[model samples]
Target: MTARTLHVDPSNAEQARSWDGEEGSYWAAHADDFDRALRAYQRPFLDAAALHRGERVLDIGCGSGLTSRAAARLTVGGPVLGVDLSGPMLRVARREAEREGLDSVRYEQVDAQTYPFPEASFDIAVSRMGVMFFADPVTAFRNIARALRPGGRVALLVWQGLERNEWFRSFATALAAGRDLPVPPPDEPGPFAMSDPGVVRDTLTAAGFDTPELTGLERPMTFGRDAERAYSFVSGMLAWMADDLDETGRARALANLRVDIEAHATPEGVRYASAVWVVTATRP
Candidate 1:
């Protein structure tokens, strides 16, 4: 497929992605890694989204189509569309769909921030750690609302805070290697962007949804069989650092994180607890 620049929510969306031509390929290559990570710790979030079967559902930022596949299994009469910006991820999803013979689930490569989905179409929209990448969440939620049936609902599972997520804190700390790397601002355009309850309510309301109910979303993040496994797991981010790191710097960074992982490791394996906000709102 040719690379094309397209508007997501509108000419001026708050949350948009260019993908840099790698979104698809990167996720496609690591589909199993992504799936395993999600399955071990994200069952609660998926369970909450798969509610009310026979109602059309949209899986936004549906990387590798895990939630999309789950959505299809949950709905017998209604169909589900999995939208993502990565072509490679969609390819993996297609193969998985074929393997499972999932006829009701369909996947598409498109920007979720501004895609022109029909108004009042979906019964529910579910996103698992996907909705936060939008540069402008207010616009993204509004666009999401455009695709929902009246009284439809939107549910999301997003990271709560950096301090609360040990895996990420350890990852960042180890990657820093004595140089003070600034933690992402709380209001930045990522998972922590939606951590605030006031902001969550404001964004949902601005996007045409009623006041949202925020449920505490927490789970154990089992990284690997051991600390070594945990170190290897985070190498995904290291691989995608988008910077030229000399061999020494890279090795040191990895070593530092490995030690941290070892410190946090348990007898059974590398388990880190993370927290997220399970936000739900109705489209009024």
Candidate 2:
């Protein structure tokens, strides 16, 4: 596999913008699965955020507006703004909001890590597996904290270690032949970027938040009506992860993914069991 850049720096916006500009069509092709996976992983974090009626909310990296709309539905009278860097994703979000006649939900395409939002503008801020790609997490969390009123709740969901998470770890191990891959640097952005509870606490406290807490949960990442649909969904995921693989390696990665799907299929569908961190903190 060749070394390629990733969307680790939330500040750069270029990589994610590139991933979206270039990889968005690929992601869009699997929009349904993406939305489903997000929804399944989001329940605990949303409950942690405890959105109340008439309280404005901010959803970071609100791809396709699924979580934003869900938050709006939970809020009843509250307005929710979904922000993302992908134009196509934001467009989808906008279209979906309009189609649902959801006036209270809006989507904006912006560099979420550095965007200059009004101070203390939201009663709550929530993200479903979206807060970990910041190149400079300190700035990102501080900015997000500044956007929330003091004592306003901030809750986000993040994947745990690759080992604890089977779907991603399985794919990585299969494609890489169980070779030990270096985890993201303590401060570098990537999946599992916020996995460590101590780091999460320290980061949130440094960002002007208090008493950051992390709760763990497990969920089934179900896909498709059957194995075919399941395989289709996981193939796209393989593409995202195997972008650097050579032809032979890529081919093998895909084959391994198929094996994984077949092995994990349930009576209703194929579901990858996943572990997550539902982290919540109050802006102090």
Q: What is the TM-score of each candidate against the true structure?
A: 0.89, 0.89
Q: Pick the candidate with the highest lDDT.
A: 2
Root-mean-square deviation of candidate 1: 2.6
User: At residue 272, what lDDT does model 2 achieve?
Assistant: 78
TM-score of 2: 0.89
Clashes of each: 10, 2
lDDT of 2: 0.76
RMSD after Cα superposition, model 2? 4.0
What's the C-alpha lDDT at position 5 in model 1? 59
How big is the positional error of residue 85 in model 2, measured in Å on the Cα after superposition? 0.8
* Candidate 1 local lDDT, residue 264: 75
> lDDT per model, in order?
0.75, 0.76
Cα misplacement distance, residue 15 of candidate 2 (Å):
3.0
User: In candidate 2, what are the lDDT values of residues 105-218, reduced to their tens digit?
Assistant: 987766667888899999988888778877777788899988998878888888877767777766666666444655556467777888888888888888889878888888
